[model samples]
Target: MILAEELTKILSSDQVTQNLTILQQHSQDESFHEPHLPDVVVFPKSSNDVSRILSFANEHRIPVVPFGAGSGLEGHAIPVQGGITLDFALMNRILEIYPSDFCVKVQPGVTRLQLNKELKKYGLFFSVDPGADATLGGMAATNASGTTAVRYGIMRDQVRDLEVVLADGRTIHTGGQAVKSSSGYHLNGLFTGSEGTLGVFTELTLKVYGIPECVMAARAAFPTVKQALNTATSILTAGIPIAKMELVDSRSILQMNRFQETDYPVMPTLFLEFHGNDNGLEQETAFTRLIAEEQACVDFIYESDSKERKKLWKARHHLSYAFRHGSPGKHIEGTDVCVPLSCLADSIEHARKKMEEADIDGAVIGHIGDGNYHTLLVIDPDDPNDRKKAHEINKAIVEFALQHGGTCTGEHGVGLGKIRYQRTEHGNALDVMMDLKRLLDPNHILNPGKLFPMSSPSTLNIN
Candidate 1:
């Protein structure tokens, strides 16, 4: 147990909240999971403070869970074992910007919107947008990717370097500012998607892109998801370099129309964005139109004005909110699966049929250019049967993805929710992961019982 006097001497009493209510509030994330409050919540102001806190926690064998914006869907920030919740809200700062180099240094707490607002002055932007205005640290932790990821790539691709404080109070820098390197093992890759298990990310250097010379947003309505997915696959195979391609099923279209007070046809829709010079954009648009016609698309509408394009994406971005609007007082549970381009159509159809048979209420949306899709299930926690049915549907979807050549999660890291499927997905590689976990965190103090389940110390030994 951590002594009060020791903690108070390290941080101001006010900086460390011992109040149960406050601790409980910081425990869970934005999901339906029951709150498991930390024993104490500490707001650290700097990397040194984080290092000191970790040192104390390591010595005492107290679990430490790093807390970002708490906007995560999988309870990644939750302190399930009840020790210390290191909230980095105070560390929120944009450290530096190098416009010429097309990179920026930011504290973990700075959000995507905050960075973009600052970067707008340079006519540059960070592209790994995960819909929610999540913190850069949290985004890096989960390796989050969204619509733009089809072209700009995920958080891992954006992150050039990270200053991470490990379990035993050692702070290390992973990677450098260079565009590419084969210098050593990829520590950046190891820590980026570790979900705060291996270390606490204090600072990050990330890649940024200049605003496109020309941008266009378009929507294609298909008679069926098969047609929509086919159009996406066709666009990819033809090497269109589409900036973004998103699929929204008819069920979600209705929910969006109701929520946004706009009347878009309730059909499986494909939302696409193309970024390039004016001529390139025109060529891509013409190519997409031809392919859409080949796929028997019902309609293809284009929005060229930036404001109008933003409005179109705004509606699509608020899809989770739309589902919540239809099912009042219900929480949204989203599960993602990515399969090979050849298998995406069949896998999605299989998932759709399963949802219909199980009588689940949800919508399918995805970055289909990457063969990644999510089925959003709205469930009322008050109804146990509804929750169970949603879980069953999610499990089946994961199984289908795995049986085919796909991952259980495309971008969302394996926090508590997907930990059970880690072994099933990775097999013996799961043992290697356990070994890495034990090697980095011998005390098991960092985000205990997450990413992977707690295994006996002997089971984790690599040699």
Candidate 2:
């Protein structure tokens, strides 16, 4: 098409394409949201390439969506307006490594596994693992957190700086290498989870951690969800430095057993981990065990062997896919909500009741240590009734979270999936956010049809 030809002139013929296969690939992500094809896809290898492309698209009023690994469950990378899709696949490069400062600089296309693999040689690691081997750019855009977040923190906390190309094609850096500064607005936090609506990330400077001296993984099963959640809260309340704490309901465990071929008991389970020196870990584990026993935990299995620990976490990481695998022809619509710790059990119980009332099929799994949980709703994609019921359950759960000082999404950013909750969750603050969007992207060319407009935008105003 004409757009591809023009972008080719700006970059190279090889970097720009209207190939039907490539367009189809960029149309959707792992989300249940319907996909839309972009008019063209452009591959950029450097910040200058991204800057020039943004400039050309901005002048002509074109929607530009940044594409990453396409692993997002919220359609964060889908190019709904069909303009120019910026694929950063060629920009995968680890630019610098400062082991002394426990930091690393990397291109947007670099995956979490890729960075962690390299950091292994230096005895350091990047912690914000959202599973799925997702690109670091996508993780930052979503502000992803995973099992380890209870200890190390989320993606926003780890990002030291970001090099961004704005809507007008101007290049700017959000922050520097300094550990802390009071110099300016905290732009680093602003852009990190902007969901590609504000700008495109070209490079990221992130903090890393030294691998723990002693690491252990354990599984504790409880008779009920409440007991498991109570055990997790108790461990946290007692000041145990648990590295990773996850909740997998009995139904989810059934799916995990079928998928991973394990003989774990079908019960509400808390997958736990501890990090510290040998002596400290021993004392912490003992205390945690005592707390679990008090909560009537039926089984407490611990492992220090590296391979066994990997297998344990592997099952947790792939639990979502397991749900999909178990259901023959159903699509999974995962709901993410984070309530206050005091309200987590109540929120989850509410979700369970709503799903029962709607007669929907799904399982509950989450990073319960931080009061975040997800209900994986399975529905027949071809059945409108089924889809409606699943969404209804989702709405009830999100409303419960919002009513109790919680967010609609804890890790997944406001993509097309969570736009309806923006007004209620942010109140008047959402208007200020929209003003910022207008100020930064006056033409609305940067990722239009996302994080605004309550519903999908049929026609975006480019004037």
Candidate 3:
């Protein structure tokens, strides 16, 4: 009852639960990783509560894992060590909004959709969306990026500062309100994607944007993936300043039709969007249509009405779910590799070819405007061979991407899934990362089995 006694003192009995139901809820994220239930789960209502809990946990050398909405595809939110899972649900609040400064200071549990809904009155919105309605703190933790990343950038770009509760229970603020700063140690960069290993986020000061004056969504179909990827390449080279560009292969298109129950063209397609002032909107649309036609477009469909535009993107956001709906009882292995924009086409082609040769049942969809694509491998999770084949394909895809100056994961942070690739991806630089993790979390009490492997901290090699 020592664990119960301490946590109950910091938070009420209701705030700290040893109930199996709540522990089960915090056991896993939306990943294929093995789940481990924490000994106790604590819901902190404010920064001071979080500070006290972390301080106590640190003193006892107990593992502490911070959990948000549990929407992460990797196992970033899982409490593998099963010590104390700190849930920030009670901290969900939009503390302040500054329209003139174009930013907002918020509690960690605020979500992207919730934030944008409030920002609508002031014509402001948060840009980064990692598909799920993930909490802002979780988004920042993963450096999550989504459809608008090509234009507005990722989670790292959205942050102006963060109120962090370190492993030792000390409170510190990273960065500042300024849009840009050459401050000490670049704590923003250090902790933004640290995945809660260095410190737990208590408050986040994030950048937001004024809503575009006009937005036009279009669906352009091509007879083949090559043609579709080529069109994306041309669009990038053309420098058209479009807002969002996504590529969905025919395989994914078939599933999208099944999932959305819409008979969109059963061909590879690009979901494109353009935003600008009212003056040249039509001209921009016409210009984009012309560019697609030049790249062997089968047909191009446009959505100008705000409601229809939202519907179109909403369907796009649920592509992975669509694929899952079509294939029952199959787990998804996302081959997330991002290369240089110039090499994106090559990278995708390589992935497609590899999947074909392996006869893996999968579909391809991507935020291609920024050179990141995921080959969704939906397979029977119970089959060892299927799992092995999927990993082989993913490893090959990551190797190809790394060779082409790409990363193993673009938007999804490296949790337990991609931990093996760190040595290969970061080279000797990973050593410094391990050193930093050890330095900040001397007891290794923070999210223990993520980012870097704990099996051999000194030896980078892993079997």
Candidate 4:
């Protein structure tokens, strides 16, 4: 019997499906990368099932791609080589929640939104919101961070421990429930953004936070991108406790206005939020307004209304989708580059120039507080020139960021999209990563065509 047939023995008939529709859904992410359906999709209900599946794949050298929400933009979940795709949806569950310790242990398939809804009952929440209701395991796989990362930190920071199933079917928990540790290896950090090249996540122990006593949201409009960056940098420099600082360029604002039906000003804008004690939040908002105005803010508006606050963030989170909807059949490819705070303006300026020169049509949205931004590139699949231009613009952006002591990807992990830039970004460290990959997964049964440049195919199978 083949691997899929063997999987049926481990899981129930309903759990192991060779259905083409399911395979196709698990094949790709929300990226422009070409999709390839897996030979079969298996839904594992628990960690032992995951271990059994991995052991079988390791023995047969069949590529095992872990499928989460399929919301990733870097094509991290794509089953490049035909094999079994492991869908963790059935495993979605909150195993435990310790409000006093401010931590939660959850299964791999639980999503950020779902967990947050559960956390809300206890006045707690998982702060990393990547816009998508992405699975916590998938978020950890990418080390995802978003607007609130400015305060609560990235997925890597929130992760306290992980239960991972290895290629040979051995299961290991990386960290403990303790607030901090000086353990043997910081394995949690290693696997948080390893993109599943190392192993599959079965369970995750993550940190959570109580909802702030006071919360306020604002929108600061600027005449230019430089002005907006200056205000954002000034806010960071002054050490204001801004929970979220998102930079939305004029083009993106227009896209949002069109798609979201909101009459936001067509200018470079910062969507900011402050979290603290009631009086302290008021003071911080006043200080932030002063800095924004001093830095050429056209207008600054603040609101404590929860519904209005949600509306503002809703528009910010839906930016990529707005751009995609704006460009009907065109494929959307984005560039994720993060740099030092001091070099952010220069990098954004360089990106603006490149986009204008290449005539690549895309919208700009970023988390300015953390120096990570993305130029959501819209590419025409049929037009070779359009694809070339988009790719060239992406390369230029990556090269500039690397030269400026920045990374090729900020929040998005190195998957099929940014694999080529890994060697250039990490240099000699790339070799070490490859060695680790070999040590952990000798047969390369996990995410075989991702992360490492050598593993990814060069030709574009853009269909």
Query: How well is each residue in 195-312 modelled by candidate 2, as lDDT tens digits?
Result: 9988999999999999999999999999988999999988988989999999988888888999999989999999999999899998899889999999999899888899999999
Candidates 2 and 4 compared: the better one by TM-score is 2
Q: Which ten residues in a row have the lowest lDDT in candidate 1?
A: 454-463
Q: Looking at candidate 3, what is the lDDT of residue 176?
A: 80
Clashes of each: 0, 0, 0, 0
Screening candidate 3 with a backbone cut-off below 3 angstroms (N, C-alpha, C), the clashing residue pairs are none
- CA shift of 79, model 3, Å: 0.8
Which digits, one per residue and each the tens of the lDDT, describe model 4 over residues 1-463?
A: 4656677788898998887788789888988788999888999999999898888777777788898999898889998876778899999999999999999999989999899999999999899988789999999999999778989999999999999999899999999899999969899999999998899999999999989999999999999888899888888889999999999889889999999998988999999999989899889999999999898887899989999999988888888789888889987777689999888888887888888898877777889998999898777889999988988898999999999999999998888888888888888999999999989988888888889843431211211
lDDT (0 to 1) per candidate: 0.87, 0.89, 0.86, 0.88
lDDT ranking, best first = 2, 4, 1, 3
TM-scores across all candidates?
A: 0.96, 0.97, 0.95, 0.96
TM-score, ranked from best to worst: 2, 1, 4, 3
Cα lDDT over the full model 4:
0.88
User: Which is superior by TM-score, 1 or 2?
Assistant: 2
Model 1: CA > 4 A from native: 1-4, 455-463
Q: Which candidate number maximizes TM-score?
A: 2
Clashing pairs in 4: none
- Report the lDDT tens digits of candidate 3 across residue range 135-188: 999999989998999889989988899999988999999988898877578889
lDDT, residue 121, model 4: 98
